[model samples]
Target: MNTMVWKVDKYVDNLENNPQVVDAANFLRKNEVVALPTETVYGLGGNAESDEAVAKIYVAKGRPGDNPLIIHIAEREQLKQFAAEVPALAETLMDAFWPGPLTIIFKRKEGVLSEKATAGLATVAVRMPDHPVALALLKSCGLPIAAPSANSSGKPSPTKAEHVLDDLNGKIAGVLDGGVTGVGVESTVVDCTEMIPVILRPGGVTKEQLEAVVGEVREDAALTDEAAQPKAPGMKYRHYAPNAPLFMVSGTAGFLQRLVEEKRSEGLRVGLLTTEENVSGYDADLVLACGRRGELETVAAALYDTLRRFNQENVDIIFSEIFPNTGVGHAIMNRLQKAAGNKLISE
Candidate 1:
């Protein structure tokens, strides 16, 4: 399959009618998988109602069949077409964070969305992406789009059009390039089936932000307990990982440097993943800064891109500095921990 790249201006006022976006939407309507940009990351989207379209998404990303895909909708009213019922809490959250990076899991209305998209589960994960290009594509296609991060399974999620092409070029139908993503991570997934909502995954929307709107929100045990099964998309598998083995260091910079030197002494091409403030503090084969630690949002935004850079440099191994698990720091730490495969080294 020849994968086409359609570059659309994200700033266009009438993006829904843009030729490039319309062309991508046309592909999607024909059950052809296309990658579209969102505020969080580029998504490998397909017709949520078509089995064939959903199957192509799994093949393109080599994603596990058991791991469900999130459904992206353009309008709020579209939720009723598939969701059996939206709880009161979910409605409040929608009012607070719809068209943003927050996915809510709700009980499904059978025979609406493809069973494959929901991994044969009774509930479905849905989100209204904030990006103009994403909304335009969703509206143009007029289908509940089942989408996951447009990257190969267990690899870093694509935050830019180029990143999508890096992993999925020639593999999918085409890419609706809308430049770089803002949030730079996936959406925060919350299961609202029960009275007390539980956070399945942390991403662009922080737990603190969610709780502020909905009051008492609980986090899934799987977020910390590795043995527990995760209820959200992209959480069941190792994700945002680089080609090289990444070990997260939860100690002082000096201790991290010592570990880097120890690896270098063994004739290894070591890489250090740190912030701009600590860039000069490390002397390794390659020391890349993933934004400033003081501002955790920057760190979260640059995390995936930095990991992809290490792959390009062909580093033998990586040692990443850990961040605080508060506010947006929670999300940054989550992705880093997953990327490192829970490989943590203490002082």
Candidate 2:
């Protein structure tokens, strides 16, 4: 497909249906893939009902067949068509946070959605995106779209339209550019099947936020269980990796700095992933300030792009300050651990 991108000026609410949206919607109706912005990240989308259409998304991103896709709907009423049962917590959570970055896993009715969308699982992950362009396109398409992050599998997920174009150009039919997404990460995926709900993947929605709404939500063991088949899109992959090997630097500041210096002295071009508080403190060949030290959201938003930038700078190795393993920090560390391929250095 000859990929084309159309930029929407803003994600304003209640705007007239424009020509670009019509064109993109037409492409989707034809069982073609298009990249559209959500509140979280750009998603490469196809008609969820068509097995053949959903299969193309896997080919476009080189994504594994077993990794399921999230079904996006423009309205809540559509869930009745596929959802066999909606848990009370799911209803409460959806009432509070639908049309945002939270994906609720529903036990699906057989033959409602493409098997490829759910990976033959009885449950289907669904989210209603909170972006004007995405909402408008979903409404215009009049179909539930199955989508995953618009980038190569195991690479950094695209947060901007340009990022989508960079990774998915010519592979998709078109891109509906809606500028930078608000939440830089993907949706927090919650499994509603169990008595105690579990988070399959953490992203824009924190565990604290989910527990506040539903009470006693827990992180799934599936996230860390390598032996188990992945229940979510990013669970079983070496995702968000840059070209160079990355390491998570643990222990004191002095120890990390000394280690980086030692590597640089060996004729290696070292890179430092620091924070705003210590941006001027690093002495590596290249240093990138991710975000303010205490601001987990800022760091989460910039994490992937920074890793991608390291490649552009041609750094041989990267060492990052250890992030707090709480709130959005957990999601950041999750991606970092995978990106670094679990190579963590501690004093």
Number of the top-ranking candidate, with TM-score as the measure: 1
TM-score (C-alpha) between model 2 and the true structure: 0.96
**Model 1: what TM-score?**
0.98
Weakest 10 consecutive residues, lDDT, candidate 2? 9-18
lDDT of candidate 2 at residue 76, scale 0 to 100: 92
Which digits, one per residue and each the tens of the lDDT, describe model 2 over residues 1-347? Answer: 68988878664555327788888999999999999989888999999999889999999999999889999999999999999998887889899898799999989999889999999988999999998889899998999999999999988888888888778898999999888877778889989888888898888899998888878987777666656675565587788888888999898888989999899889899998988898987788999998777888888888777887898899999998888888998888888888888889999
- For residue 209, what is the lDDT in candidate 2? 86
lDDT by residue for model 1 over 222-325, one digit each (tens)?
A: 99898887767558778889999999998888899899999999999999999999999889999999999888888888889999999999999999999999
Q: Pick the candidate with the highest lDDT.
A: 1
**Least lDDT summed over 10 consecutive residues: which range in candidate 1?**
229-238
